[model samples]
Target: MVIINPTISTQPAALTRPAGPAPVLPADRVLNAVVLGERAQHLYELSSGSLRMMAESQTPLREGEQLQLRVLGKDAQQRPQLEILQRGTQDISPQLRNRLPEQLSLNQLSASLNQIRQGENPTLRQLIAPLLSSLPRRQQLSDSAGLQKALHNSGQSLEAKLASGEAPKGDIKAALLKLLATVQAQSPPPPKAGLARSYGPSNTPSPSVHAAGSAPADIATPGTASTAKSASAPQPQAASTAPAYQAPPKPLGLPGELQPQGRLPPSPPEIEGTLLSRLAHDVKGALARQDANQLLGLHSREHGGSYMIELPVRDRDGIDVWQFQFQPPRTERDHSHNERGSQHDTTQTGWTLSLSFDLPGLGAITARVTQQEKQLGIRFDAVQSDALELLRQHTPELHQRLAEKGIDVAGIDCRRRSAQALTESSYSLSALLRDQA
Candidate 1:
């Protein structure tokens, strides 16, 4: 359409009739879109969602090309207007951006759970037990089927799984959600500000409370001592300044108040809620990072069949996480990556597999394997020199196993791990259970 100030902007007006109702996105929501069809006659179809007539873009718009846009509210005809925000899918979602700074870590959560497990509440313990039991054992990841199950339980695609009516099994995110809600339900709420203030500002303790081990029997007059024992006991210290938690009349998703918070509650009920809230924050943070990686796979220059999965396995020293990524081969019509221009390849029915994990003896290791036809090429990057040597020693057996699977081993190499190849446990997730397992 019309290009102004080097940006492609469009006024989405329906050609035949008024523009139809489009999907409602927040005014600041930014997303990516690809040109599916060729541009012709300068006339465009104003779709209800992704509204567009004359689109504003920084880059030249062509078929199969992708550009980013930010929702800018409705236009004169009440049609949505999207201003091109960036040129690629690399721009992370604002919701995710806000979450990154405040998110918690699973390592910390495991420690918190250990402390929380000491509580005497059998009901709370029941909720926590399933989560620990669901963790896969070290031996489970030895087979392909077990590995598949781990990937399925990562809890990234939870909403999609629930929406499809195919319940996800052992989804960690779903477990976190349930555990948080249950803990919140059972938690002993802290003292309310108004109720505490009514006790008066005098130095003597309130008549209703007797030091640390007392409960109010009946309401006493403000600033007046009811008994001799109450007059000698310490008066109510300044009421706790921190805000109190209130149960929503009808809860939606996790509230902002539940985000990973500081200071544990005094009672068992409160402690359970605090620990579970932190755990949920860490798990959901991983989900957000997984979503970002997936968005890149879809809108990046690659052929767009890419995935990242994180699996947490139970080991002798608590939990060890493993990461895996799969990328499908590119096609002839694939868009050029950066300045390389178009790459013409007729035969690319291959795939790439990458996995990173730390073992008892191997330390941190990342393995990348590319499969073309029946042939395979693999490279192992190990952080420790001893680990690299050990991996090299195992290559012969690894090659032998591939051959047994009818795979032609082209080459196998081991090298020191680089920063780029090093993987963290935070950004990997897959399935989300529809209901608690």
Candidate 2:
């Protein structure tokens, strides 16, 4: 064996290799994308899918795998026109199905996919992916081939027929030449307001839907002829008379008789108590004066299916109380708010409130609804232990539901952020309000 230099060691200083392809993305990482169109384009990220950077030759942009979109120009309406530079793998979603042209055959689409997969010259894999997924689910290549062939043949025949026409007759040629000369001799005319309808008879009446009017051989019913004659009359004034109103009555409503609406009968007076009104009053009083010290004792429940009492505490200085008004059905307060069953009126508070509620099947979770200008924004708070566990274990299912509504919640670390802030739970609000007053 050869003697190695003691200073150099056996490894030869381990030659460093350049970095390889990027690691595959986790399902929760949001992948940014740009949708380009003549009208409007969107730059967004898909939060719940895998993304991969393909080889440069396979997908063109100089960046190789990483795709960056450049917005070129805005149309008259200020919509963006975009162009993509790199290629990345994107997830197929039902929403992306609209990118394909109407009536594209599945076979043609498959061929297009093959072209993209092969990374051929001038191939656009990124552009092609959206179109492939968007084709109508019901389309079949075998069925469409016959129709496509017929159309191709018809186009060829039409071109041949146009080419095979005989030379124009002497008189016809002379007349056509004269007409052309006259047209050329005249100055271009100003555009008219409307064009005349040229396809059908000028006075053509709307077709009678009945079978009798469809064919000349069919015997006309007693009043059908008269009705047709009256409809075709030239005098508008006569057509507007009582005699013109003698058209046949329409068939009785639809095939099925109108089903009576099933509105819930009114609840008993005792069941519809003043609890909601009382709760609203307390919330309104605390929010209007911005009094943090205000507190209210409300009946609530816990996640273990036990009914308990909850005390809502607002900490601030105030003897001030305000009357609260409840708008009708549309504006009725939603009391099933939190695990403690406490409701918060952020709209009146100009702040955000998180309340947890224990419900069957869902266990417990807090819904944080914020008041922003004139609208109320709602989102789930991560306080519910059971719900967070479900989310962590079932990421894909959660993502699918959230994606349906275009929500990209990929970066949320639920386990790390699902703790509730500790606060004093004294439900004795009425006595406190009295003391402050």
What's the lDDT for all of these models?
0.50, 0.27
lDDT of 2 by residue, 127-176 (tens): 33333332222222125573243222211122223224423222211222
Q: Candidate 2 regions off by >4 Å?
A: 1-355, 360-363, 369-386, 394-400, 406-435
Per-residue lDDT for 94 in model 1?
Answer: 34
Q: Which stretches in model 1 have alpha-carbon errors above 4 Å? A: 1-92, 114-125, 188-277, 280-305, 331-349, 418-437
lDDT, candidate 2, at 162: 26
For residue 341, model 1's alpha carbon misses the true position, in angstroms, by 18
Instruction: Give the Å error, residue 83, model 2.
Output: 67
Question: Compared with the true structure, what per-residue lDDT tens digits does model 1 show for residues 254-274?
Answer: 111111111222223454444
Best by TM-score: 1
